[model samples]
Target: MRLLITNDDGVHAKGIHALCKELEKYHDIIIVAPDDQRSATSHSITIAKPLIVKEVELPDIKSKAYSVSGTPADCVRVATDQIIKDKVDMVVSGINIGYNLGTDILYSGTVSAAVEATLCSVPAIAVSTESSAEDYVYENAAKYIKKVIEVAVSNKLHEDIVLNVNVPPIKDEDIKGIKVCKIGKLQFHHYYKETGKEQENLVYKLEGERVVNHVEETDSYYVDNGYVTVTPLHYDLTNFNILKDVGKWF
Candidate 1:
């Protein structure tokens, strides 16, 4: 299979590198990633600026890698529309440094990249590692991702659904098991503090850490408890249950 891999963490990230190394064993891989970290840039495209693409070489991975001056979604779009052009069999995003779970998916570039691929009618998966430390066990995450990808390819998941996988930071031996779950309702409080006064205007910035999620069955909780969480996500954002009621209100 020909796989097109991308990430929001940029071309030089160890996560993507590890993923490419593991994936290259069984499939032909091509990587197109942001030139710099674009985390939380969800499905954004570079419209005003001219997007640039350049070929790059990594240490051990022998796949054809490209660096893009855009968000994760742009990389997938360009890789499918221009670079590979209908030759791609699958699209895999991330092996991200941090977890993207629950409501956080709205701000995640990792999930957006996979969503973009699914929109193009290709199967995709978004993989993330839940680690508080700056450096994570990317090799283990990559191995697990490779196994999941093999299963996905063999079983052929629904085209409209993308897998959002979050792995714990623990060693492989410490991991409990993988769980297929639904997206749980988890939220973080946003706090701001006044930084300075600029030009007679009060300037404030985000201050305070993310709040601890209270939900028990959430992906966040599973990761916190050393279990890999696999959530199947769809592209449609419609609230079908409220459609008729909303229409009446309008």
Candidate 2:
């Protein structure tokens, strides 16, 4: 299969390269990623200005790669609509530095890239790792995705659905296998800090405290318990169940 690989952590990140190396061994790889980190960028696309894209080289990457001076979603948008010189079977995002799990994925550029692909009528997979540890275990994530792609491609995934995968950073032997689960409501504790520099006027930084999620049948819980979680996500935001009741109010 011909695959379009992209990520939010820029084209130079080790995670994307590791994924490309493993995937290129079996499928034709085409990488188009952000020029720099664009995490939590959501699904925003560049407009009213020219989107600058350039062909670049990644160390040990045999596939054709490009860097886009835009968000992760922009990379997918441009790649499918223009940058791609040929046909692509699927869009595979991430092997991201940190996981896009539960409610956190709503603000994740990594998942949004895959969401963009789905909007373009292409099947996509967004893979991420749970830990941002110094020893980032990416090879296992890549290899795991290989199997998923094989199954997904053979079965022909629905264009509206994206497979959101989150893997624990532990060794393969320690992994508790895969779990298909729901998206957990993982709420985070964060606050904006006021910088005390007289030279600068009101500079603040967002600092996070704790992320809480304990739902057993959800993505966060399964991943936290040593399992690789797979959640099938759709781009539709409509609350169909409430639509009928809302119409009655009129």
Highest lDDT, which number?
Answer: 2
Off by over 4 Å in 2: 133-136, 197-201
My TM-score estimates for the predictions, one after another, are: 0.94, 0.94
Error of 1 at 221 (Å): 2.1
Candidate 1 per-residue lDDT, tens place, 1-250, comes to 8999999999998889888998999899999999999998998889999899999999988999999999999999889999996578889999898878778788899999999999988889999986444444788888888888877878887777799999888889999999887776544566889999999999989755556674777787777788998888888889999999999986
Worst 10 residues of 1 by lDDT: 130-139
C-alpha positional error of residue 85 in candidate 2 after TM-score superposition, expressed in Å = 2.9
lDDT of 2 by residue, 45-119 (tens): 889788899999888888999999999999998998898877778999998998888888988999999999999
Off by over 4 Å in 1: 132-136
Q: lDDT scores for all predictions?
A: 0.87, 0.89
Candidate 1 residue pairs that clash: none
